[model samples]
Target: MDTVIRMNRRQILTGLASGSVVAFAPGCVENPTLGRSQLILVSEEQIAQLSAQAWQQSLQRERVSRDPALNAQLQRVGRRIAQASGLGYDWEFVVFDSDQENAWVLPGGKVAFYRGIMETMENDDQVATVMGHEAAHLAGRHAAERASQQQAAGIGLGLAAVALDAGDVENTAQWAAILGAGVTFGVLLPYSRRHELEADRFGVDYMVRAGYDPREALDFWTSKAAQRTGRPSVPEFASTHPSDETRIAALREYLVARNYI
Candidate 1:
């Protein structure tokens, strides 16, 4: 039994390493800007198509801002960053008439910002900070890569269970819980934190190239961190994003490393 268990473990590890679990070269492609290879299961055309559907749905459900001043400001800042992004995406920036301090970007450069976040920004540099970050997610191919990784993980877990069964190992509730927690905290959450940091670093670079002050990025995040102190707390490992402290610290380190100040 001991020898059989050892053999099964070896087979599982060998399968994982030999591309039986993850075909490293298939869906993986090198992103020149991020200088990394990403697993992109979904094609750009599919993402764009889905984005268009989402954009249309949002337009129907959300009240778009007609504030002339806000519209003009968003357009001005968005154009500068879009030009600097070098991603060649057809960027569309819209301001939503809401008080939620939030912003998001869809694939193919569809971006929406709430009036709440806009009102909080002291300057266009702050806007550029967010825009650059969202754009970096796109240029970094994060959405597709995330989907692919999750899919692969699901498949791998299923295979792992099968392998364990073949080796006469029980897939008990405790084992399931342990494995689930390990995947969530050790792999998925950490990957998300890394994505956030990568976006932050690339965002700062985009801000600088777009003639926005990189210092404003730091200031903006610091202000956000202060705001979060009064809000409900979320554990870093349980959340898909890193804590504000972690993000801010990483941003500062990256800024200093790149001499962005």
Candidate 2:
């Protein structure tokens, strides 16, 4: 986690009132994989607990595929990335019987790959592209960081409410509007972009370490980019992710800089 703790208006006001100064959350830690510090209000225990519940829920909700080949491929590729990451997570990968081009990994190395995404992958290398990226998200501790940031933002909004109350501003409608804008622009959008890019860069590193060609990563994204040709796209500033072009360009630069090409 990031080292310095910067309190928002709510913490500042509370400290002044109570004559005490401290961080809103005390669980900041440095992550070796990300090469930076993070504000992790949510602990590993909490994430594991929640992930266990979520994994169970997913098992009940989604249709799990029992194809032997699919299961074998997921286990093989996922294990390679897991080994490269050097994290001793009890990894389990499943293929869901759905047409959604999506895959996600929970904190405890619980992964779900939709049949749609699997069908789109041309080779095991492409599967490794998705696997490495999702694994990098876990290694980077992006989930806990996002949760902490949102908690801080919520505290800021609470403080703003207090300030409004002190000033006798009774317009509840106006307060809601301001809070919505603060959360959308301040907390959610920016961090999402950063997380995606970080995952992309570190994902390629994992791919190379796992003995997968980095070029396949670029190819996978290029194909996905083509798929988005006729669809609408949110502007980069307001979006939760970098545009495909931006993401692909960054991947190319990383591959070149690291000599992974």
Candidate 3:
């Protein structure tokens, strides 16, 4: 009985790895905001449902700050950017009471900013810098595209695993793990960096449209780069985000081209 169960599991894995698993045909849809076509395997409704769950989880997991000043500023900047985005995603912004210099956005316009990052901003224009960037992620439909890419990569990795198993390769588990890391660092991370750069460019555009000083975006990113001067740097290729210098340089070029500076 045990041997039968083991064989059945192996067969199932092998079948899946051999591309026998059924899935929707991948679709490339035009994203008007980004001016590009994106591979979107999942529906917007599905991504929104997931985003709502994630938003709830985040509220439950993090210590939500009730600081009136912080909340007010976040709302002020967030609304302008949201309006500029024109995505109409039922946008919600919450400030987490953390010292980590981090912020993130979920699909459907859910935005979270940490108190630490908020404190770093010297003025509303600086706040607008980050706000517009988060808004651009929604405008770009990045979450759905990222999920689709991962889904595709998973199937490819499964095939690699099955091939190794069929060949009776030694340390198949180790090889599979290595292959998974390769997909992450090589494929996914690079795409993430591209997304970051795209956001930076479009975020500045949103800032301008929302009546914020676009040059402040350059100042904000430059200060961020300086703050990281002493920290250990991650290689651009391996990191999920571009280096601060890379971001600042790109932002400067865009601002120049647009004559915003």
TM-scores vs. true structure, each candidate: 0.78, 0.79, 0.81
Global lDDT of each candidate? 0.68, 0.69, 0.70
Top model number, lDDT: 3
Q: Give lDDT tens digits, candidate 3, residues 78-149.
A: 999989878777889889897767777777787888888889899989888888887887788877777677
Q: Which stretches of candidate 2 lie over 4 Å from their true place?
A: 1-27, 155-181
Model 2 residue 257 distance off true place after TM-score fit, in angstroms? 0.4
Arranged by lDDT, best first? 3, 2, 1
Q: Rank the candidates by TM-score, best first.
A: 3, 2, 1
lDDT of 2 by residue, 1-261 (tens): 000022244543443444223334547788888888888775555445545555666777778998888888988999999899887899988898877677777677887877778888888899999888888888888766765666677743222211111101011123233346667666665776787789889988888899998899999999988987887765666655677888899999999999887
Let me know the TM-score candidate 3 reaches against the reference structure: 0.81
Clashes of each: 0, 6, 0
Candidate 2: C-alpha RMSD after superposition: 10.7
Residue pairs of candidate 3 with colliding backbone atoms: none
Which segments of candidate 1 are over 4 A away from where they belong?
Answer: 1-25, 155-186
Clashing pairs in 2: 1-29, 1-30, 1-37, 1-38, 2-37, 2-38
